[model samples]
Target: MGILKHYSGGLTREQFLFYEIRLVASLICENNSRDEIYNRIMQENLFQYPTERMIRSMTNICFKRIDSLASQMLMEHLANASTAVAKQINLYAIMRENGIVYDFMTDVIGEKMRTQQMDFSHKDINSFFDTLQEYYPAAADWSESTRAKLRQVLTRFLVECEYLDNVRSQALKPVFLFPELEEGIRQLSDETALCAFNCFC
Candidate 1:
């Protein structure tokens, strides 16, 4: 919910790596040091990402998203919650870690929901990016592929988190936050970000 000072294309690298995120959260819950976690992931191919380079890249992305949360309770929920709840928590973590996604959710997606506008399209995504470039001129430097992938990733994330029925439908779906997850978010004093989850708190 804080002001976005910059935009990042990190989401393009991975779109809601739910299993990988849960693994990282479980490792963190086990009190594994960062290096220990990274090494274990590298050695065991925990992410099953096909190659060393991919495994390393995914490990770094997972850590970047998970570490910024800095909430043991949230991590525990992500590691142990039921699938629906865990996915919601993972989406929350992503919004916290990625400003571009956070704004897209609250400003574009949330606004659409508020106006009862259910149609989501590539045009909407492009307009959002156009506005972002205006605010952060450096975002204009991203390659076209990067922008395309980001659009794909964000749409896929919305589907994964149940904010949309599916990519093809692109219809807004109501997201009712589990009480425990809502409480966990509140504990972080970031209840404002709950708008991204359709909580509108």
Candidate 2:
């Protein structure tokens, strides 16, 4: 079952918006310590996020993502890249590394792709969640409303990352890795490379 007993991310769609990607990229480019970067984001009055907690969450997530990729050189490559898509892909990788839900979500996508199931549907998402609940009893307690929202937000994230054609539409779109991105991935440890490849693929 792909269900999480105690899902850890709990991030809203708003927290994963395009601007946040830009914000993360900027932070990575600055290459400051986590506390220094957090202070810079908070004091510079740049993002205008909802609360201090959300800002902290974003900062933590970004740092965790950088760590998961397991290479400061790759982080530098990503920070220097020209396309927003590269940064989004990196963020998506981080999300996969840091969030149980994201790992399951992408695994489902990869499975469907391998099976040549090109079009995804809401029913598939429901089934995936249903399967999760079977293994994670706690998942059974999640409200239908909450499940629906998560499904919507996850789909939106895929669309933003060019993994899907659109929300509510399961058309899988492959993102071609930039040359620098590819090089960086190759430089990572075998385990980290495999994990990053799963997200990139």
Candidate 3:
């Protein structure tokens, strides 16, 4: 991944896409339940232990944002997932599509927010790129176009309106990018998932 990956927009699409990967991994792991999931995550080849809390925060925060943004029909559909296992899958899939994150998830930005203050060079971006790249199976072969789509969706959520005030602890968020080519990203970038999404936001 190139340093500060750039897209058609100024948002942190790459950062949020990284978080979404964590979301999917967590869900897949969750399908197996906490102990099993934790073990899979603990495997040195798989999930890293240090950022596990951030994954949980992402999940926790995502649901809240979804609840706030989704409509009664969408909410009802989520309710229909019924089982924890099923709900987990539905949520995982939705985040995959919508690129929306909970306001509190921005807290992860705090740890690396000052990365700019340092006289960082292009090399520094690799550390975060490595963290993001490792979370997914190395064998997975996603093309550049597909990856751009993933980042594009994430950029929508990282925009201004999606942020949380956090009156209790005031802090701005961190954003990052990697420059690449894309065609008609706008054709794909929109907040509305359904008529309800149009009605709600």
Clashes of each: 0, 2, 6
What candidate 1 gets wrong by more than 4 Å, as runs, is 1-6
Give the per-residue lDDT of model 2 (tens digit) for 60-129: 7666566666666666655666655465546545554544445554557656645656677787777877
Which candidate would rank higher by lDDT, 1 or 2? 1
Instruction: Write model 3 residue lDDT over 102-169, tens digit each, in one string.
Output: 11122133233433232222233233334444443431354555545544443333332222233222
Which of the numbered candidates is closest to the native, going by highest TM-score? 1
**Tens digits of per-residue lDDT for model 1 on 1-201?**
443333577677677889999998899889999899889998987777678888878878778777767688888988998999998888877887888887888888878776778778888889999998877776799899988889889889888987777787756876687876788778777766776666774
**Which regions of candidate 2 deviate over 4 angstroms?**
1-9, 179-201
Model 3: lowest-lDDT 10 consecutive positions: 177-186
CA displacement after TM-score superposition, residue 109 of candidate 1 (Å): 1.3
**What lDDT does candidate 3 reach at residue 106?**
22
lDDT of 3: 0.33
Candidate 1 clashing pairs? none
- Model 1, residue 141: C-alpha shift (Å): 2.6
Tell me the TM-score of each prediction against the true structure. Answer: 0.90, 0.74, 0.25
Residue 122 of model 2, lDDT score: 84
TM-score of 2: 0.74
Count residue pairs with overlapping backbones in model 1: 0
